[model samples]
Target: MNQLRYSLFVLLGACSYGLHSSLVKLTTNAGYQAEQATGAQYFFGLLLLLVVVLFTKRVKLNMKQIGSLLGLGILLSLTGVFYATSIEQLSASMAIVLLFQFTWIGIVIESIYLRTFPSNLKLISIVFLWGGTLLAGGLVSGHMDWMSETKGLVFGFLAAVTFALFIFFSGKAGKGVPTIQRSLIITAGGFLTVLLFVPPTFIVDGTLTGGLWKYGLLVGLFGVVLPVILFAIGTPHIDSGTATIVGAAELPAAILSAMLILGEQITPEQATGVLLILIGIVVPQWRSKKATHPKKVYMN
Candidate 1:
């Protein structure tokens, strides 16, 4: 039951992450640029997390711990930039398909780091996840163009790599720190990363007073604050490979969010893909349960 609870936390976090694209589209429609959207997200995300940390229990950490968490946050910021830029150069479907590569990449990285191979069950789940990604991303329906520029492909895959790293490391970094404080520091790191690349003109410009702050607050709440706190609470309890597979929840959630928020239509193929992704998530958890409680044999 505890493990199930941890998995639920991670699942909810991934679903919160899936809310990001739709929010970005809505913000864009309101005349906000992509960079500004990202900048506001991290900025307000850091602020909200800071407030949460002050109200929660806090802890002290060494320089190494702080540095590691900041590095993890940098990976987070990098993934957003790369994934968003990829969508600009390629079809949204294609960019998503490429970004979804994080699932396998994460598993491989975990295996390499731990000097162990993935279980056969996990490998099978990977197969199902890849198939679902293709379908859910619209590749199977011929909605994607294969002729995207090399930069877009590179950016998409880079996004995948950084995101995979973040999933793998978030569990391991600052292991003793309080979850909210850990999240706050990570958000601060990410906000700093955004500042390096973005002007933060949203701060002094009429952008915030002009109503971009509304989008910023919403984006920070869903995209940054909730996910980080949930992942901080959940990831340490789950293995990196399984954690990556579980995070595939975001793909289906993203599709559903688009349908409801943007009034986009979902096709039969996409629905089936979402179903398969759910099955893939179930596959490992089911195996975990069986492993924990094997059937007893009756001697005749």
Candidate 2:
């Protein structure tokens, strides 16, 4: 029951991420630039995190540790930025499917870092993952126009790549810091990263008052603040491989959001793709037959 509760937290965190692309699309439709929404997301998210952090007791860290956390924050921010840009060209559901590539990408990262090949189980998972990706991406339903959507494809893939890196490092960075405090610092770094590409004029350009703050608040709450907080509570208790499977909730949440919020259609093929992807994520994590020495087969 305790493990189930922690898994729920991680599940909710991933579901929160699924809301972001749809929100970004809505904000874009309201005449806000995608980049502006990214900025506002981090801006408002950082402010909320700071509020929570202020009431908590403080712990000090040296510059090196701070830098490491900040770097991780930058990677987190890039995932959002790239996903937003990808949604600019693709349907919200499709963009999210691309971002879900993070699953297999993470395994690859683990393999390289561990200096060992992924076990046959994970290799099989990659095949299922790509097969589902192709179907879910609308390639088989004949709606596949991304042959012309090069930039969107690239950005979407980048979102996956960066998110995978973030997941990889999150285990190692800020190991002993309080969760909220670490999240606050990371959000601060993310806010600064967004500012680098998008000017901070929203601070004064009447945009916040001009109704931009509403979108910012929404995006910030769901996209950054809640997910980070929940993951901080949840991820530590779950193993990496299981967490990856639990994170698969994000895709279904995204598809639902795109359908209900963005009013995007989910074709039969895409639905099948989602199923396969989930299968890919779940099946690999099962203890393999040679499980006497589990490290020999990393489902992670």
Candidate 3:
């Protein structure tokens, strides 16, 4: 029952994350620049988190822990910045596919850090991942948009890298802190990074007119607050392999959200590619044999 509950939590977390792409697109369409949107997200995200922390829990972190958490925060902020910029350059669907590349990138980073090669299952998944990326990206179908694709590829890959680092470091840091408290500190770190990248004038001007608040709150709710809290709580309960498979839910969620909310086109080839990617994510984590009966056997 506990496992089931955690699985559901992770699923919800993925869905929340999936909603982020469309939300970011919406914010941009509402006339906010990418930096403006990203900055607002972090700024308001921190404010929301601060309120949560003060009312529910007080975070107490040592200097070393603060340093590690802040490092993770920088990576998190970079993901927001890069992903928002990427989606601005390309369709939400395409940008999301590129960002989802972080899954395999995380695997590679893990392998290198552990000084070990990927498992055969992971290698097989890698094949499907790259193939799906090509098909979903429209590269295989010769439907590429040269100019936007170039910019999207650059920022999307950067987002992927930063996302991988965020995952890696978040796991390593603040092992002993309570979940909510740790989340607050990490959010503060991201807020700092956002302030560094986005000019104060952009954030100030956006806030003064009250135009950016709705989008800021939206991004804050979906992108940072809800997903972070869900993942922080649920991920600790699941093993790495199962967690990885479950996390793949974000890809399809993002794709579907783009199709439904943003009216983006999803070709049959892209659908097939998405299926392949999902299959790759699941195959390695699947159990090869059924559970054996403990006390009874059927007669042949």
Candidate 4:
């Protein structure tokens, strides 16, 4: 039951994350720069979580906890910067497929930490994931925009790496901290990290006045606030393998949002690829009936 609850929490987190790109695309199309959107995202997200923290009781944090949350916050900022740039440079669908590379990357990280190779199932899933990626990326459709594609791939892969690190360390660190408290501290760290990337003039200038808060609220809630809190609450309860596997839920959600909301075209091939990837994701969690029970024999 606890497992089911946590899984649900993870799925909710994925759904929130999936919607992120679509909303970001909307904000960017509305004439917001990536830096502006990103800066606003973390800034507003910090404020929102700060409010939540104030409402809740406070817990004392030691230096170790402070350092861990701050480091994770830095990675979170990298994920946002790289990912939002990828979305701006490429179609949202393609950017999402590339970012989903975190699937295999997470498996590799897990193997390194545990000093073991990936299971046959995980390796197989990786094959399917990449296969889906090729189709979902519109490369097979001969729609390659190399100028944008090159930049997108670079940033998208960076997003994947940073995001995988965020998941790995977030799960392992700050286990003793309260979920909301941890979320707030990490968001504060993210806010500070983001401030470093954008120029001082950008934040201090009048740019924040023009309907920025509306988009900021969306990205802050879905992109930063909910996912951070949900993952923090749930990831610690499961192994990183399962946590990353469940994180793939963001893939289909992103693709569908791009197609439906952004009006990006998805071919039949890409649809099939999405199905295959879903199969790969589910295979790891499947428990075989035969493995669960065995027949008993009695001899006279």
Best by the lDDT measure: 1
Q: In model 3, which runs have C-alpha deviations exceeding 4 angstroms?
A: 1-11, 84-98, 143-155, 206-209, 237-246, 287-300
lDDT of each: 0.90, 0.79, 0.74, 0.80
| Candidate numbers sorted by lDDT from highest down | 1, 4, 2, 3
Task: Give per-residue CA lDDT, model 1, range 228-259, as digits (tens).
Answer: 99999999998888889999999999999999
- lDDT: which is higher, 3 or 4? 4
Q: Per-residue CA lDDT of candidate 4, range 1-300, in tens?
A: 455467567767887888887888888899988778788888788889888888886678899989899889999898878987887788865777778889889888999999999878777767877777677655676676656568888999999999888888878888889888899889888988888787635456777776888998898998889999999988887667667777877777777888888998867887877787777666655433244455888999
Q: How accurate is candidate 1 locally (lDDT)?
A: 0.90
Q: How accurate locally is residue 36 in candidate 1, as Cα lDDT from 0 to 100? A: 89
Using TM-score as the measure, the top candidate is 1
lDDT of 2 by residue, 211-267 (tens): 999999999999889888777677666555456556766776777799999898988
TM-score of 1: 0.96
- Error at 264, model 1, angstroms: 0.8
Candidate 1 residue runs with Cα over 4 Å from true position: 143-147, 294-300
Better of 2 and 3 by lDDT: 2
User: RMSD of candidate 1 to the true fold?
Assistant: 1.7
lDDT of 3 by residue, 29-74 (tens): 9877777777778778888987877777555678998898778788
